[model samples]
Target: MNNNSNLSSNNNKILNTIDTVMGVKEEKEINQQQEYPPLNGQKLLIYVMGTLAQIGFMTLTLWLINLGFKQLLEYNLDVRINTIIVSLFWIFFTIRSRLFSPLDNTRSRRQYDQVIRPKWAPPAFVFPIVWISIGVLRVVSSYLVWQELNQNFLALPLIIFTIHLALGDTWNTIFTVEGRYGLAVPVVIIGPLLSSFVLAYVYGQILPLAGWLIFPSCIWLMVASVLVINIWQLNQKD
Candidate 1:
């Protein structure tokens, strides 16, 4: 009887061990499934639409604020204080508008890689650095323009600058977010590239130093325009 009981106990232990191992395996699979849920076509469509909606709202709000700034400048505010306030607004707007896109994700990066780039295209890493520098130049140059105007935000140069900012954001949406490379070509030309040149000319008229500061961005945008045109031609189907 003692031998039989000892054998039964060993069998039960083996069964329990197998059950535990199977449970752990099942749990791991469940966790993995939860972590990376399947992204179906409908889900992807919803995500894109949602992102577009958010961007649209943001652009509208920014425009309203731009108009509001025009009214605010009409007040008898101190010049230095107004300059600081206006600079802060532009800085916040620039950073937020640029960084609010969904292109930072792995999927977007993959999509960018899948596109056929020009032989002279700069590396993907160069874009952020270039854009950030350009953004800083924009804010500084605008500040200088405002100061040169004697705190006149209603001037033509500042108006052009505001339009330029809007166009830049719009081009980003069309090119990167919407994946409309063909449509993006014209948008890039008439939008940011044209605006850059206009801004350079206007800024130069207002303040020579401001114009020079923004001129490099114009050249950069010119190169970018050519790059986008090539990209559209190469990836016509995409």
Candidate 2:
């Protein structure tokens, strides 16, 4: 059996949604008091594959942003590099989610939250401070094609989603401490999807593009995110 029972049912309900997305099997314990299964060689392989999938997804995200900047905004070099830097930090932290777990009261964890998250958060915080800054970053970074390429209002959703991704760990810690971390997977995924769609609509108004890609983008993200998580899950057997 696996550690699903260790998670709260509420959290499991959310995790169930991720299970639907990733097709992960329930690792039920033979006895209620039984421990999670020990990891083995086969499961480790599966875990690594899942991790690689996540890495590839982040890389693809980088490429998509690059394509949008060049094709739509006609911006190059510094713009692409800056955008990539932001995305890299975002993806880097996300992939290292375990390392940043709020439960991680380790010295390294403090360093990451204080030193690391701050390093990345500033430029992004400044991202929406100016109209052009908001326009350049949010417009193309978001999937909306219709949003204006140079406007202030577009920062609304972009700002929130960024905060959500960053603060999600804090929320998870709260849930875990409250005896509810089990359902972390689903809530994390769905919350972002909803916020993302809203952000897309906001971006559409400011700098409109094809609205059709919004849902598709969400699905892709779901699949991509699950694929990445599955990697770590596979290692749980170890």
Candidate 3:
């Protein structure tokens, strides 16, 4: 009877050991699955689609601008109406392109105003200057196309300029629209750095005059980025 009881006790202990080992293996597998989930093809497809959409949209904008200039040269539009149309068109286009959050929505963010704004934030006058500089650059680009001057070589700087604009506007949307100021701070810096580098490229390989014209805008962007950093710091509680 004693020997039989001893054998049963040993069998029970062995079963317990087997159960514990299986439980640990199952837990490890669960953790592995959590750490490394399956990569869905849908994400890749969405990324590709988004990139293609942005590229198509920007190219269309360039085409429309060129068309508008052609019409202007032909005196097809009344002077006052043309000015109004161009202003409204650009305003709507920039809004639709998500350059900024809705004015009302951005204004609703009381936290942005709770702290004193940086003194160096671009003043009202600076905006017109920046816009004028951008317009000059666009005109220069159009002139280059009209003159049939090394467009193939100039293409890189133009592409870079487009990218810089997109990134800067996207950063604005992220900060003002999404209220992701922390993430936007880095983006603000990055956008200007990209613009500066592209300006250097334009100076070296493209039109030196065009490069000089855009340099002030680059400085403005850097100043804007610094202001953004200050804003982020002030609103950290959010």
Candidate 4:
């Protein structure tokens, strides 16, 4: 009779332990559900639409400003008026987004010459104009991708371009402004190469025109890489 009683007690304990464990798991699941709602199809669509709209808005604003400048120049508008318009436009965007800073390039060039003047570096005139053209192309490509947000095929290229832009900006700041060439060189090399590869894919698969528009950026990146390589070679002795 005592042996049977002990066996019954052991079974009760095991049952109690399992109940406690299941209760804890249920509580955890409930808490997770309360914390983060499931990202259903509607929520995902809203998120993507919001992102594309923002991109389109910003690019359109900048492109309009460029168009305004061109028209002002064609009609022989006052230089001061034109300057003020461009300056204010840039200042607004710069204040809103550090990524769109107008002063970074000037600062970078000044710092670049101060840190090291590579023999292979392009002329001062070349960089600013090339970057300006690239900026326009960036806006164009972004606008194009924004238009095709629902297509799914353009997604990878836009993602790659975003990373490329971020890396390029970071490389400039660290290498040129902060004078951290060791880290910057890798970013410059890898960022552009990755950008080139994605752009090639984009040209073949998704939007050929947009990809062609981005070709200059890739070419400029190659030239920039050569300059960076030269700087590394020349500065190692320092």
By lDDT, who's the top model here?
A: 1
The segments of candidate 4 whose C-alpha lies over 4 angstroms from its true place after superposition are 1-106, 150-156
- TM-score of predicted model 4? 0.52
Worst 10 residues of 3 by lDDT: 99-108
Candidate 2 residue lDDT tens string, 104-174: 21111111122222221333212112222322343345533313333221244444434334343333332
Candidate 4 lDDT, 183-220, residue by residue in tens: 45666787655666576567436667777777877877
- Residue 187, candidate 2: Cα error in Å is 2.1
RMSD of each: 17.2, 18.0, 24.4, 25.4
Whose TM-score is greatest here?
1
Minimum summed lDDT over a 10-residue window in model 1 is located at: 24-33
Instruction: Evaluate model 3: give its lDDT.
Output: 0.51
lDDT values of the candidates?
A: 0.68, 0.39, 0.51, 0.54
> On residues 1-238, what C-alpha lDDT tens digit does candidate 3 reach at each position?
9999999998767644543322212233222211222224773354235434554566566566657656675876676776565555444443334322122122112334344567766543344345544555544543443234432322445445555555655554455445566766776776645666575556535556656656666766777678778878877722
Candidate 1: deviation at residue 159, Å?
1.6
Clashing residue pairs in all predictions, respectively, total: 0, 15, 0, 0
User: Per-candidate TM vs. native?
Assistant: 0.62, 0.30, 0.52, 0.52
Clashing pairs for model 4 are none
User: Which 10 residues in a row give candidate 2 its minimum summed lDDT?
Assistant: 104-113
